[model samples]
Structures are given as C-alpha cells and as structure tokens.
Target: MKSMKSVVPHLSFCVFLLCGNCLAAPPSPEALDACMRGWADQNLFSGTVLAAQDGQVLLHNAYGMADYNAPIANTCDTRFRIGSLTKGFTALAVLQLEEQGRLRTSDRLATVMPDYPHADTITLDMLLNHRSGIVDHTTLPDFQTVRRTSPCALARTIETFQSLPLDFTPGTQFKYSNSNYILLGHIIESVTRKPYADVIQRQILEPLGMHGTGFEYYRRPIPNMALDHTLENGSIRRAQDRVMQNAHASGALYSTAHDLYLWDRAFRTGRLVKEKMRQKILSCDAEYRYGWATTEMFDRKILAHSGETEGFCSTIIRFVDDDACLIVLSNLEGCSMGRIIQSLSALLFDRPYQLPKKAPTGPQASADYGAYVGRYQIKPGFFIDVTTQDGQLYRQATGQSRLQLHPESKDTFFVTEADARITFEYGGEGQVARLVLHQGNRDFPGDRL
Candidate 1:
C-alpha cells in the first residue's frame, strides 16, 4: 500500500470511494480529545466549529474566549468577524441585480462607473471572477497602518489602489483582489442609490432572515464580538492598530455559526439565490468562482471561501452534492483556520490521498534549487522570498517571521501558512525570471532581481 511507502500516502481509489460513503461514525471522544489537546498545546486553534451533513448537525462546539482578558468562554452564539465571506453576500447582491434586470455579468465596468480606472477594459464578470487587473487597494503601502488609525472611506481607498498601474490586462488570469468585490459593493450602491449596508439589508439579510448580519463598523454595537488578537514579537496583543478599512466587499460582517447555518440551508434550498442563479454562481469560474474558491475533493465539487482581517480569520467549506459543510472562525490575526478546516474535511471525508513514497533525490542540482530562490512581488507592497533551508524550499513574507513552503511536486511550492502559493517561471537563461503567487482570484507577478 502507498501508506507504507510515501510520507503522504495517497488513499487508494477503492478507499476513496468507501470513505466518501462512510457513515458519520462520530469521531471517538478519545481521538477528539487528543487532537484538541494537541492543538491547544501548540495554539493551532481557538474558535468554534459547526459541521453538518445531509442537513443534520453533526457537531457544534466553541473554544477559547470571546474576551481573552476576562477569559469568557466562547459559545456557539459568539459572533466573529467573517472577513471575505461577506463577498458571497456581495456576489448575491449583484446577482439579485441581475435578477431584477438592473445589471448583467457581461456589462462593462465603464457603463457602471465611467470614472473607474481602466473601466473600458474591465467587465462585471471580471469583477465577479476577480480577473480584473485592478490593483488590490489593501496591498497599498501603509494600508495596515492606515486601517489602524481610522476607517478609510470607500472612495478614497479605491482611488488609492486604482492609481497604481494594473498588473495585467483584464480576462488574462485569476488574481484575488479585494478591490474587485469592493467595486461590486460600489456598484450595488450606485445602482440602488443607497449605502452598501442598506442594499445588503434590503437584498439579502432581510429576505433571508439573516438578522445578525450587517456592515456595522462604527455604528452598530457588536454583541458577543471576539476582539482580534495577534502574537507579535513573542507577545499576544489585541490587534487594535490595524484599522478595519470599511471592508464593504473585502472583510466586513459579524455572524454566528447559527446564522451561517441558515445561509447554508438557504443556499442549498435555493432561497437566497434563485436555483438558476445559484447554479450559475456555483458553477461560474469552476476553478475560481465569484466569491468562492473551488476544487474537486474526493470526486465531489467543493466550494470554499476564507477571510482574514486585522485580528480575525475565518473559513467556510461546502460539498455541493452531499451538502457537507464546515465553518471555522477565529478572533486572532494569522490564524490557520483554512488549514484546520481542510484537515477536518480530510478527517470527515477521508481526503488528502496519501501519495506513494519515493526516495528523496538527494541534493537536488544547485541550478535547480537556484531557480526558486528569489524575491517575488505579490502585489506592489507585498513580497515573498523563496529560499532553500536544509535542502527544502521555504517561503517568507515581508512582515511575517516564519518560513513555510510545502512541496507541491518538485519545482512548485505551496505556502503552507496562507491560501497563496508560488510557482517560479524560468526564462531561457535557466534562472528564475518571474514568480507567480496564486491566491484564489488574484495572482501576483514578480520579476527576478
């Protein structure tokens, strides 16, 4: 069996079929205890879980504290900032406009916002698919510092990033830019002639009965809200410095698992989005949907999305066929919620097929390793350093200290820390020329220095 040979043994084709159909034998208490304890020891997770299959709630558990200072135990009702999951709502709002014949996906950006940079070349579909070459405003210099001091108005923020030249022409490739959805938010406002909050409420929340969902940054009082925390310089501190730049379509919205479960049910039953529109939303850009990042797992269509803000992190995963879903939310910056959810999916559906073992090709050619070592400018301000340590390649971001680069094959290395990865593009000189960082819907291009 591959399990005996490979470090990551690929599950056998037969095992894959059997495991997908395996009845929900609740994970043994002992196993769950060991896993949780191990994670706590390493501080890998400190949040909540809501898992369901076939519309049956399998498990709903909360961990850690809503207020770490007072150490108030978190409950299922505790609200956490759901970051970009708000994009799904934004996408739904645009689709609702489509339903009303107010907008079409094929509509050109110039028609909606004539003043928008490169409006003539970009399209609404590009906004939905994140193929629009608009530079992500969040990637601007001192964005985090600005976000900490005061909430940036949407127009100023969009203009700040819009001034930079586009990374590429529209409709060329995927680059997950928060600016895309933020623009959608602006479109929603422009078309409806109202604030984003009003449009979201009238279109999605009120209809779906998602009473708890809102874009209340400074207006609405957050109840049971988890303060964002981060471990920096070896001490854990509240991430109060990074301002919440009116996330609009990027990262705004506080929701509980219960409300999110309602959303899941609504999506499956075709309540929030019409059946045809839902299919379109789910099927469009199959590899990279409007708001959701997609992949085939265990031969089932898996739709997923993740969010990150100053101090909060969250992830949502759904299996379209079986309606299996998992949602994880945290109040800490840089939390690996996405990795945890993927691991959980592996546990539940028996995934991450273990590949057959092969002997390490000792001491890869120096030239081969040299091709991956270079600086990659992900956006303008963000850069990644791919270097080899102890023979394996590692990825290091500008502000982050840890180095994690997971091997995808031989030349490709996936960032184990975030939902981003780097693939070195070699030129004829046999040296790394361009490095592409693939972050769902967004791609970063960097030239070798």
Candidate 2:
C-alpha cells in the first residue's frame, strides 16, 4: 500500500454500502454530522462549520486535522485563511471611515493616488462594489508567478497594472476584481496614515472582541492555526506559502468560524457602523454591496461571500430577513464548500437535503479508459489533459495539479479532491466527443481538442 511510503497515511474507509446504493439520504441534522464525519474519515474533508439563528447557537463543530503533521485536530476556534472573505472586512473599514467623515464614497481614486490610471473617473463607490473597471491582478499570469515567489508590496503591486486600460467604463458594468480591494486597502492606509492591518485591528477586530481573527503572516506562527492543504497530483500536501503581501488587504485575513459569526452578529445589532451606512452596505440595487453578493435563498434576502486562495476556501451567508447565519471555513481547497453551505441552510429551514454519499466505482472495460484519454479544452485558452499511468486514470488542469478520477458508472467519473465529477458525451459513432465537469452547482463543458 502507498500508505507505507507516504507521510500522509493511506486513508481507510468503511464500506457503508447502505444496501449497495451510494446515496442513503434524507439525513437529519445529526445524520448530516455523521455524513460529514464519513467524508473526513475517508480523508476527504477538513474544516469547521457554524450555524445559528436569532442569536442562538444551534450547531458548531469541526472535523479533520488542522496540522496533519502535528496531527492537531480542528476545533471551532481553529483559525483558517479566508480568501476573498477579507473583502467584507476591507469594505467595512472603508464604510466605517466614511461614517467618521474621514472620506467620502464619491471621492475619486485619482485624488488620493494621482498615479493610478483612470482615477479621475473611478470613484471609491466603484471600488467598493467591484465596478472600478480594474483588471483582476490575481488572474494575470505574471502576477500569479511573482506572488508565489515573494511578498508583494502595495506600491509595487499597484504600479504593475496602473498603466493598463480599464476592462469597461467605470460603473457601467459590474466586474469582480482583486485589484479593487487591494487599492481600497491602500486608500485606507492613505487616509489613516496607519498600516492596513493596524487600522483593521482598531476598527473591526478590536471593537468586536474578535481576538481570533487578524492578518496572515507566513513566517509568524499562529497557535491553533490549521496548516493549509492543497490537492496535487492525486495527493494531499501542505499548501505552498506565499508572501502575505500578495493577498494583502484583498485576501490576507484569517479567522475562526466562530469569530466570523461575531462578525455577522455585529451587522445584525448595528454594532459595526451607523444604521444608514450599514443599510448602504446591505443594499441590493446592483446584486452586490461593498463586500457581499446579494441574492435570494429560500425566498429570503441573503448577503454572502466565498473565498478561495491557494490552500484555503471559506464561505459566510447571512439570511438578513431570517436573522440566521451559516459559515464554513476550511484549510483544504475545493472541498465542495458551496453545496455544503446550501445543504446546511436547507436543513436548518426543514427543507429536504440529501446527505453526501460516496461516488460509486465500477470496473472499466478493455477500451473504456482509452476512449476518454485525451486533451480537452476547458476554456478557450485552458485545457485539461487526461492521461493514464499504471492502469489508473488522472486529470491535470492547466497550471494545476492532476487528480485521479474514480468511475461511478461507465461514462461518469468523480474525484474526492473537490467533489468534482466528469462525464464524457458519446457521439453517434460511440467515441467520446465532448466532456462536462460538474462541481457544486456549476458546470463547465469542454470539446475534445
């Protein structure tokens, strides 16, 4: 067994066949915990979840190991890096500064940073709501390369894309961009003449007594902090450390699931800012507010956000109308976070929720593997190369680690790396012609290329 040779011991799973059917569901909330534990026992899940209603704590628990090396188990208080969820903190700080009459939302970026391109036309309002027309630095190939190697500096990072043209007219359309929040972080610094971290600490974290949350520093050790993990080539490994400056104000924050609940509670009680300002932040005029995406779930107005970085993923959903909140934080990336959040919300409302089941596996035919082994275009410029080695199949995305695919049926396959499934569509002649990758609630199709 590979377990003998690898640092991470091979996982052992009980075959709870549930009568030979992979899915045995309509699980109660308690059963949901068992289902989640089942995934963890299979070496599939690692994280914490907190669900509450009307200021009442209903469910709070953690699963899997925080540091697989130290073998530290995750707890409700274990801190995890929360990718873009930091945007909410960033946006709140800006709005708080506005409430203090320190800055106005209509202020032009050019007024504060003269060198920024189109600063005259882009307003603070635009940056807060992701209508600034700035290109997402996170998606740029060069930025991605540089970030992994070194700590990104604010000035140097902003200058990298200052001269570039806008993706659209300012405020004319909505486009999510990391550059927007990075710039907002800088603006916070400029207005207060303090480090963004210090300002955030003073404004939000300190005020709420959220001692468990703060900025992430790679070299600085955090007690009870879960080591981030990433899936690479069908194996789980420590997530690569990047310069904290790379994520900076945009995504560098870390917090526990419970602390995030305090965050949500702050809004509920109007403790974060004045009611009028808070209302502005919660407005759904444009499908998004300062740091939240506005949407309807179970016919209730919900403000939510999800975060994803190299080794971490997180989500926070606030049912504004129902006075309820659901938060999930993870050290592992792409662990089916979206579906899990949705299912938890449903269970809370007495809606039907099917428990997660193991993706079934079956024997492959003589030519079964060969027909699906080929390169397919995931997007115009992205491709997934499917290859087999030692009679086992694996898939690699562009610039990403490969994962093995387990067959549930003849044409369908799934992977535990992220609850992702793939299926090849057959043509009239029977050879595969197109592929579909399904995870959570989204699907991406790829034509054989």
Candidate 3:
C-alpha cells in the first residue's frame, strides 16, 4: 500500500465529494459563544443553549438568571417549561406505540373513542399531521381564565372543544390545533392503560437517559427549574403562572438544553425508534408532521419546533442531514426568538449575521410626538395605540401592556423589549396615515383610524 498519510487524505477527499454540501465545516464554538454573550449582555435572552454536530457538543452554556428575584444564575442543567416543544415528545410516544402494534395511524377516531362527534371521518394520521380540522382548544373564549384557575383532566379538556364544529373536512386542509395532540394524549393513555406521563417516562425518557425531562404541574418543586419571566413596558417581570395540567399533552413538558440535545441525538442514531419509524416522524407530506415543522434554511433541510407559554419560549432546530442541531430554552416571554435563531444559524453556516445593538436614544423632546399619538387598526378587533408621556413615546397593543418605543429616526422607533420596529407613514397633508410594524422578517401595516 501507498503511504498511510496519502491514503487518509484521499479517503477524506472522497468523503467530502460524496457528501457534497453536507460536509461543510462546523461553526466555531467561540463565535457562537460570543454571539450568545452579546445577546445576554443586551438582556435579549435568558436560560440555556446547546449546539452540537455529529454527536459532539460544540457549545453548551447558560446565561442570565434562573430566578431574577433570587438573583440565582442559570446553569447548563437549568430546566425550562418548553411550551409546545412537549408536542415532540407526545408525537414520539405515539409513534413508539405504533411500532409496538398498539395502534395504527390509519385507525379512525371512532374506533378509538367512539363517542367523539364526527369521529368516523377523522383518522389518527390526520391528527398527527394537524390536518384534522379540530378547533384549537387554547383559542376557546374561557381558555385563559380556566387554565389559570384549575387543572382540567384530558376528558374535561376534550369537552371544552369537542362539541365545536370542525373548521374543515378532515384531511382536506391543515390547521394546527393543540386539541389534536391532547386527543392523542388521551389515546395514549387509553391504549396503554397507563397515565400519559408514566408511558413517556418508561418508554422514552428512561431509555434515552433524559432524566432531566418531564411533565410539569402547578407548584411542583423542581430543583434548578428556571422561573419564567416576561418583558413588559421595557422592564423584566415575573410572568403570570398557569396551571400546567391545563396544557396537557399539548405544551406542559419542561427540560434543559443538555437533555434536549440527547433527545435530538436519539433521533439521529435511531435509538428511540427504528429508521423507518424515524423517517415517518420526520415526514414532510404536510408543513407540520408529528409535532415538528419541516422546512429549509440556508439550502439545508430543517426539522424545527417552537413553544411559547405564559412566561417561557423555547426552540429546537435540527439539520437532520448534517447531524447538527441547536436548542434554545428561554424563560423570558415575548423576546425575539426568531432573530436569535436566525443569527445563530447564520453564524453556524458561515453566513452573514449581526450582533445585538444598543437601542438609540433620540432627542429628549420632539414636536412630532403629538402627531404620532393615535390609534391604528391593524386588523379586525386589533389596534395599536401610540402615545407620548414625559417626552417619551409608547406603543400598546390591544389588551397588552404599553411598551416604550425608542426613537431610531424621525418617524421610526424600536422597542427595546422585542426585535420590532414601527414606522409612521404620512399622507399628502403631512398627517399620519398608516403605521407599519416590522417584526420576525414580516411586515404588518396598520391604517390610521
């Protein structure tokens, strides 16, 4: 044989050629570290983050405080209520049951829960893919008050939305409904003859060694659990608490970034389910599949999901083909998670990314302040009221607390609490006509009423 060094070099070149764009170099940990540190210093993020490639961790760190009142710092092991990220676990449990021949995806809802209205027309697959047309229970009129006051069992939760008419014929359209997953949770319990939480603990968490993950309940003392916070009126405050059981299988799980990393790795290594079943979980026949959303970013396929509750928001993104993943678990609600995700992903792929910038302070007083004060209708029953107090501008959405708007330019202002900007547009007479809200890479124009 030729020299071993020459052979190694040839093998490496062939591997690169075979893998094509999938073989690009992984992002530097230092770069990711610097980006996160900048965000934390700007108070843009709190909680933990983990990034990994090819089963090896590149950056695993925590930032800000776990409990702002106690001034306790967060660690890598800090657990966070992951909101809708719990759906992924619920989905996986369903798939595992299928693998065990407990139930088939094609089974009709009537076959499982015969009493549900229109059950005969809906299939389990429809629920899995969010094509079931079931109304989202969380959108019901009493959801906020009821969820905060009491814990509703799955059956009682089902009663909240069961009688509501379907939004569309099952399997003809896709509509994301927490009710679908809640029903799946009930099915899991019914078929296994065990509580949904127990099934998850025994089948998934224990086997994957994810000891830090579990369902959350009200007032449960979980060690190192981060207290949820929300940005309000340009200040950080504790978020309003909700009864976790109300979230049910839809969004009640809490976990750490490290444990979530293990969750991602299990999917990659086929440790959770066989390869065929894994593909089924990740299938993109619809925009939503088995609790994850399938999409592409930077020309690479991505399986991602995000969760938001009263005081917490979380995200997990997996570049399945490249074996790379990013997990962000945050306690502060209403923060710009999209901006953070996009920036981190850009750094990961060597694309252009920007660091957080300090909010600008414009003049102490401006004559235009009075002109900008008015209510603009964004849509039906939704309005944004702009007002000035003590020479500072503020914007308040319908039913939300007023947030101070920092002047970025003569007619444009930014909110320090979120990655959002507002621009005032004037009509021919120099009168304010419309305003535009720029956030999360989208623009919403609100006409002056």
Candidate 4:
C-alpha cells in the first residue's frame, strides 16, 4: 500500500499506524485526531473512536456533543446505544453455554423455543448465522409506535411475530434478521433460568471488566448517556426511545469506547470463549458467522457489524489477524457513520478516501433513462426493480411500494423517501451491469437480473 501524499496532497503529513506492513511507522495520534476533528467539523461523525493494534491503544478520542441541546461535549466515557453490535455479545453467551455442554448450536429451535412459529424447522445455528428464515418483525407495521409508547414484553413480542410465517426455508440462505438474536436471548433465559442481562453480565461483561456497558432500558436514566438525535429535511430533532425488550439481545445494549475496547481484547485473545467458538464468531463459514458479517476490504479479512436505531448508528470492525480494530458509536441519526469508518480504514491502510463533500445535484436533464429499467437482485432475498412509467423513472423493492427515482446524474438516481442514492454502472457492452445503493453510510450492490 502507498501513502496518500500524492492523491491527497493536503493529508501528506497524516500517516497512519498500521500492522501487516512494517516499512511504514504506525499511524500517529495526530493523524487520527486530525481525521476525526475534520469529520466532526463537517457533522460526518460524532460520539467516539477507538483504534488499537497489538493490544496497544493508538487512538481513543470522542468528538461532537452528546446533548446538543445543553451542548455538553462528549467524552471518552460517553455511553451510546450500541444497537446490533450487541448481537456479537449475545452470540458469545450462547457459545459459552455450548462450551459447557448446556446447549448446542445444532439444537433445534423447537427444543428451546417451543412456542415460536416454525420452531421445528429452524435450528440454533440458523439463528446464529442469520439463516433462520424468520421475518424481521421490527419492520412490521406498528412495531415502532408500540415500542416507542410502552415496555414490550418478550413473550408479547414473540406472539406478534408467531402468526407470521417463515421468510424462507430454514438453512437455505442468509438474510440478516434481528428476530434471530431476540429468540436466542429468550432461549438463553430458558436454558440458564436467568434474565438476558444477568446471563450476559456474568458470562462476558463483568468478566471482561466492562462496567460501563449493559442492556439499555427505555425507562431508565443513564448518567452521561448520549442523547439520540435525527437529522431530517435539514433539521435536527430528538428521536423517540423504543423499548429495550423489543430489541433484546439483538440491539438493546449500550457501551462506551473504553469498555468496548476491553471487550475487543477479551474476545480476540480467547479469554471469553474457546478458540473454536471464537473462530465461529470472528470468521465466516457463511455470509454471516454467528453475529458478525465476514468481509474483505482492500484484500484484508475483516469481521465487522453495523447498528442503527432511530437516532443512532454504530460499527465495529476487527482485523484480527492484523491486530487492529475500529469501533465507532454515534448518537446522531443519519450521520455518515458508514463513510466515516470507511475513511478511517482507508487512512489506517494508507488508501485514498475523500472528505465530506456536498451532495451532487441532479442533472439538468434526463437522457436515456430507459436503459436502467430492469430488476436487480442485491442479494438472495433483497431486490430493487427500476421501472419507467410514462416519462418518469421509479424504483421498488420486494414487498415494498414503488418510489420515484429523482435523477441526479444521467446514471445516478436519488430516493428522498428514505435518504438513499443510487449510481448505476455499465459493463463492457455499455449496458447496465450493476447499481450501488448508498444509504445509512453503507453501500449495497445490485446486479442486473
């Protein structure tokens, strides 16, 4: 890898400390600070950043305001809702039980969650690996309203989803679903005869010395906790708090940068689980392994996860073999967390990444819009259909209502309904080959189908 001196002349002095390549020195603290400060100034990042290598802290800093209303500046100890990052911890608890011969990943869901719909067909492994085929009940109607207004019971939550059929055949494919971890949390309680919070605390949290992290309760008051805010239509507003039980082990937990750093060390060194179980958590046998998504970025094997609730977003990526990690927690909604982490990763590896820029406006006129009219399969169960009606172009997803695609550039389209942008790509023959959907700071690629 080369330095950014040539491409990004301004960041020539911002060299990063990294592993794998020894010719260059580790990224300086100044570099990380400068990178984060730049992002904070642009509203692209807030909350915290913790980066380390070989068990050494390289960067641990907080930026932006935890409560912009009072304008309390965030600190390293600021607690932010970790959202789905909690799944990795939940997965570890289950693996701990498995190591004790109390439960097996191969256990049939029916054996534990007898009342759950289609329990006979889904296995524990399916849930862990996100191949359970259960519909993510979170996306169902009234889920948001009900959760925001009341404390949701696990049993009641399960009942609401039980009437719904499986999303697909169990173990046949992968589609990440929070419903899986929620059920796993229930199963943990059944097997250990303890609350999910108690089980997780004893099994992982307390053991790892993570005192600043635990289950988040909607009704509870947490000291120094970051308030979640959403940026909408160019206005920032408070986001409603949802029931913790609604998210359960799937997305309800919260943590600070320091405590999460302790967790990373414990997880990476096998102090928390057996090497085999650790491998299952940190490496991929499928699109998702246990609780983490397996990915390759710049040819580096990385195990990572991202989380988003109403007013917050988070991501933790670990390059275990390279002894590196990036944990970002933000209390601001629609903050470009995806792009922030990607930029940080690029800096860590000396790759070229752009700074925040104004969104590209739509082209003055539409040309050959008909070329993008087709169905695209983003993944096994996800899709986007681009179609034209009369003289206008539109996009639709499986089981979703059609949305109009406002042309930005000739080959680019933006969706205002949920703040997404799509840029179509062409192949050698000059026809549409793929499209990348940019939303929530991450990119999803859909191929012509």
lDDT winner among the candidates? Answer: 3
What TM-score quantifies how close candidate 1 is to the native fold?
A: 0.72
Q: Scored by CA lDDT, what does every candidate get?
A: 0.68, 0.76, 0.80, 0.76
Off by over 4 Å in 3: 1-26, 361-367, 399-401, 440-443
Q: After TM-score superposition, what is the CA distance of residue 374 in candidate 2 from its true location, in Å?
A: 1.6
How would you encode candidate 4's per-residue C-alpha lDDT over 1-449 as one tens digit per residue? Answer: 01000111112122333335323223767777777776687555678999887778889999988988898988999999888888889988999999999999998988887876788888999998888888777777767557545788887777777778788999999877777887898999999999999998999888888988988876789888999876543345677666655688888899998888888888877898889988776555465787777766667887778787767778888886788888888887666665567667776876765444433355433457789989999899989999887666788888554766776666887754344779999999989998998864567899998
Model 3's number of clashes is: 0
> What tens digits encode model 2's per-residue C-alpha lDDT throughout 72-141?
8999889988878888899999999999999999999887888777989999999988898998776667
lDDT of 3 by residue, 346-444 (tens): 778766655555666455577668899999999999999999998778999997778888788879988866657899999999899999998655678
Q: Which residue pairs in candidate 4 collide? A: 16-27, 17-26, 17-27, 362-408, 363-408
Candidate 2 TM-score versus the reference: 0.87
TM-score for all models, in order of appearance: 0.72, 0.87, 0.91, 0.76
Summed backbone clashes in each candidate are 18, 0, 0, 5
> Which consecutive 10 residues in model 1 have the weakest lDDT in total?
1-10
Candidate 4 or 3, higher lDDT: 3
> On a 0 to 1 TM-score scale, where does candidate 3 land against the true structure?
0.91
Candidate 2 residues lying further than 4 Å off, grouped into runs, are 1-32, 232-234, 359-367, 397-400, 418-420, 428-430, 436-446
lDDT of 1 at 174: 77
